[model samples]
Target: MAVATQTMTDEQRKSVALEYLKAFDNAGTTSTGGSILDLFAEDAQVMFPKWGLATGKKEIGQLFTDIGGTLTSIQHHYSEFTWIFSGSDLVVAEGTSHGEHRDGPWRAGVPEWGAGRWCDVFEIRDFLIQRCFIYLDPDYAGRDTARYPWLSQD
Candidate 1:
C-alpha cells in the first residue's frame, strides 16, 4: 500500500481536513461516490452511528449509497475541532457536528427533519482518511429543536 512518507505542517494538515469536509459536504445531495471516497485511503474504515462499521472502499462506498437513498439533504457543520498530529503519517481530529438533516428519521412513521449533534473522530494517514468513527443520537433529528433549551431560545 502507498504510505505517506513525510510530515505535513499544521497548515497542510488543516487544509487536508478541510478538503475532506468539503468532499463530505458535496456528497450530501448527490451520488458523487468517487468524490466522497477519494479522500480516504484504499483500506479505510468508517464506524458510522446508525450504519455500523464499513471497511475498505467498496464497503464504504456502499454505505454512502445506502444512506444517500434515505436523505434528501444533509450537512456536517463542525462546531469545534481538536487536531493532534503524530508525525506526518497520522492525524487525529475530534469534533462535534452540529449539522442539519432533511428527509430524515430515515424510516417510515418518523419525524422528517433533524438538526443536532454528532461527535466525530477522524484518523488521517498520509493525508488521507484512515478511519472515521462517529457517535450521535440517532433520534435527535426527529425532535423539535425548541424542546432543547440549549439549541433554541424557546
Candidate 2:
C-alpha cells in the first residue's frame, strides 16, 4: 500500500505558517465569527498541555472560545521560529511566543495578569494547520512575581 499526502514547497510552508500566525493575531482582536477556524483543515486538531486534544473545527473553536473568555486581552509575539519539512505535505514549525495575558484571578490576592513565554509546535498541510501542540507554564497565570522576581523595584 502506498501512502499519499499533499505537498508544499518551502516557501509555501513558510507562507502558511506566517498566515496562520497573522490570522491568530487578527482573531484575538476581531469578531469575525470563527475566522480563526478558517485557518485549519476540516479535521484539524489542537493539543495543549492541560487542555488535551481538541478535534475538528467545532471542538477547536470551543477551546479557543473558552480560552478567550479567561482573559480580557492576550497577544502572541513570535520571536523565533524554526521550520522542518517532513515529506511534501507535512511541515513542523516550532517557535517561542512572548505573550501577555490579563483580566482574571489566578492568585490569592492578585489579579491574573502577566507576561510569559510559550513554546508551540505547528503542523501545516496544504496551506492549512493540520495540528498544533502547545507547551507552556500555565501556572504563570498567577502573580507575575512568581515568574518575574527580577522586576522588583525595591
Candidate 3:
C-alpha cells in the first residue's frame, strides 16, 4: 500500500490515531470482522503479542477468522493510551490492555484479573494498521496464573 503524504493536522492526526486503535480495541469487544476492517487500510497487519502476525488484508482477514474460531473472545479494557504520529500514515499507539477471560481461565492468553498490561505499537498506514508489535509483561501473566494455582505447571 502506498503511504500517503497528505499531512494531517495535529488534531486530525490524533483523531485518525484513535480511530485506528479503536478498530483493534473494539475487535476485542463487539467486532466480528467488518468493524475491525473498517479501521484498516486495504493492506494491514495484525499481530498477537507472542503468537502470530498476519500481513495484508487477506492475511488479516484470516487472522481474525482464526481468532473467531479458536478463542471465544478478546475481552479487554484499553486505557492509558499515548499516541505519536510518525508521518502522514504511520502512527504508534502505546496503551495498557486489561481484561478477563470469561469462559476459560485455563487459556494462556486470557487472564484472571487483568489483560496483562500490554503495549501494542502499531504501524498504521492509510487509517489501518500495516504493522504491529505487541509487548506484554510476562510477570502479569504469571501472576494471573498464580491466582488460579491449578494451571501453572512450570
Candidate 4:
C-alpha cells in the first residue's frame, strides 16, 4: 500500500501566504473573521525578530501577544509587496508597512532605514503554514539611533 501525497500549485501556495498576511493585517479586527492561528498547522512554527522562535500554536500565540501589545496599528503595503515562489512549499514576501508603535509611528521610505520594511519566509502545505520566519527591524520608533552616530540628529 502507498500513502497519498499532497501537492499544491504555486498559486495555491501564494494564496495561503497572502491570506496569512491579510489575517495579520486584520488582527484584532472582525475583517478576517478568524484567528490568525487558523491558517497554521497544529505544530506550526513562527519566528520573529527579537521575539525569537515559537513552535506550536500556544507559543505562537504568546509571541504574537507580546508583539501585538507593543503596536498601536500596523498595515502592510499589499500593492508594494514582492512575492517569490520556490515551486515548492517555500514562499517569500517582501514588503513595506506603516504603523504606530507604543513609542511612535513609522512609515516606509520616511527615514529609509528606521523601520517599516520587512521580509517573511513561509512554508505552506495542505493550505496551512508550517513555518514562518519574519525578518525586520523591531525599532519602529527609531529610538536606537544612539548606537549609530551615522544617523542624522535632525
Candidate 5:
C-alpha cells in the first residue's frame, strides 16, 4: 500500500471530503460513474453509529454494503452543510439529509429530534480519505421510540 503523504492543501482536502459525500449520495447509481470506495486509501478506517469501526478497504466495503442495503435512497443537503477545517488533515462536515429507509422515510427537522441530522469527521491526505467517523441516528423510521419515553407514540 502506498503511504499517505500530507501534501494536500486544506481546500484540496475539503474538496476530497465533499467528493466523498457526493459519491455517497449518488451511491449505487451511474451518475458518479465510480465506486465510493475509490475515494478511500487502502488502509482507510471508517466508523458509523451502531456499525462500529471498520479498518481497511475490504472491511469498509462490507460496512457500506450493510448500511446501503437498508437505505432505499438518500440525499444530503449540500446547501446546509457546515464545514470545519483543523488546519491539517482533519475536516468535519455537519449537515442534514432526507432519505428512504427500508421501513420508511425521514427528513431533518421533522419532529425536531428525529433522524436526518449528521456529522462526519474526516482525515484526508494524498487526495484520499484516511479516516472517517460518522455520527448520526440510524433509526430513520423512528420505530425505536419504545426505548425513549418522549418518542413513544402512546
Candidate 6:
C-alpha cells in the first residue's frame, strides 16, 4: 500500500470521487476490470449484498475480472450519485449502473438485455478511497434467463 501523508479534506475527497465516475465512463462496452480500481484505495474492500466480501486492490480487481467474464462489457452510467460526507474522512454514495450486454451470462435473454442499480458506502482516507461496500441483485439475470429461450436454464 502506498502511504500518503497529506491531510484529507472535503474538497480533495470530492475531487477524488470523480475518478470513480470517470472509470465507468471509460469502460465503454468492454469490462476492463482494472479501471474500477481508480475508485478504491489500494487496501480497499467491497462487500456485495449476496456475492460476499473482497479485500485488497488485487483481490477487488480480480473480483471484477470474473464479473467481466460473466457478462458482456457494458459501461455503468451512474445517475443521481451524491456523496454524503461523514466527518471529511467518509462519504457514502448510492446510484444506478445501467448498460446493455455487448458478451456473456445475460445475453440471449429477453432480446432486450438488462441493467442494475447499486448502493455503495465508501470510507475515504488521505484523499484516496479505503473501502467500499456494494449491494446488487442478480435475480434479474435468472429471471431473464428463464424468460428467454435462447438462454439456457442450466
Clash-forming residue pairs, model 5: none
Lowest-scoring 10 consecutive residues by lDDT in candidate 1?
A: 103-112
Prediction-by-prediction clash tally: 1, 0, 1, 0, 0, 2
Q: What local distance difference test score does each model get?
A: 0.62, 0.62, 0.54, 0.86, 0.88, 0.60
Which residue ranges in model 5 land beyond 4 Å of their true spot?
1-6, 28-32
Candidate 6 segments whose C-alpha is farther than 4 A from its true place: 1-4, 28-35, 101-115, 140-154
Candidate 3 C-alpha lDDT tens digits along 67-99: 554433343343456767665555566655443
Model 3 local distance difference test score: 0.54
User: Candidates' TM-scores?
Assistant: 0.64, 0.66, 0.59, 0.92, 0.93, 0.65
- Candidate 4 lDDT: 0.86
Kindly provide the TM-score of model 2 when superposed on the true structure, using C-alpha atoms. 0.66
Q: Is candidate 3 or candidate 4 better by TM-score?
A: 4
The residue-by-residue lDDT of candidate 5 on 1-154, one tens digit each, is 4675558888898888888888777873333587888889999999999999999999999999999999989999999999999988899999999999998999999968889999999998888889999999999877888889877856
Worst 10 residues of 4 by lDDT: 1-10
Instruction: Indicate which candidate wins on lDDT.
Output: 5
Local lDDT at 86 for model 6: 83
lDDT of 1 by residue, 1-154 (tens): 3576755676676666667665666763224455777777899888877789999989998987876555554455455666676654455665444334453433322332343444556666577777877665655455556777865753
Candidate 3 regions with alpha-carbon error over 4 angstroms: 3-5, 28-34, 68-79, 87-89, 102-115, 137-154
Candidate No. with top TM-score: 5
lDDT over C-alpha atoms for residue 93 of model 4: 94
| Model 6 steric clash pairs | 72-103, 72-104
State the displacement of the C-alpha of residue 84, model 2, in Å, after optimal TM-score superposition.
Answer: 3.4
- List ranges where model 2 is wrong by over 4 Å: 1-6, 28-34, 103-115, 140-154
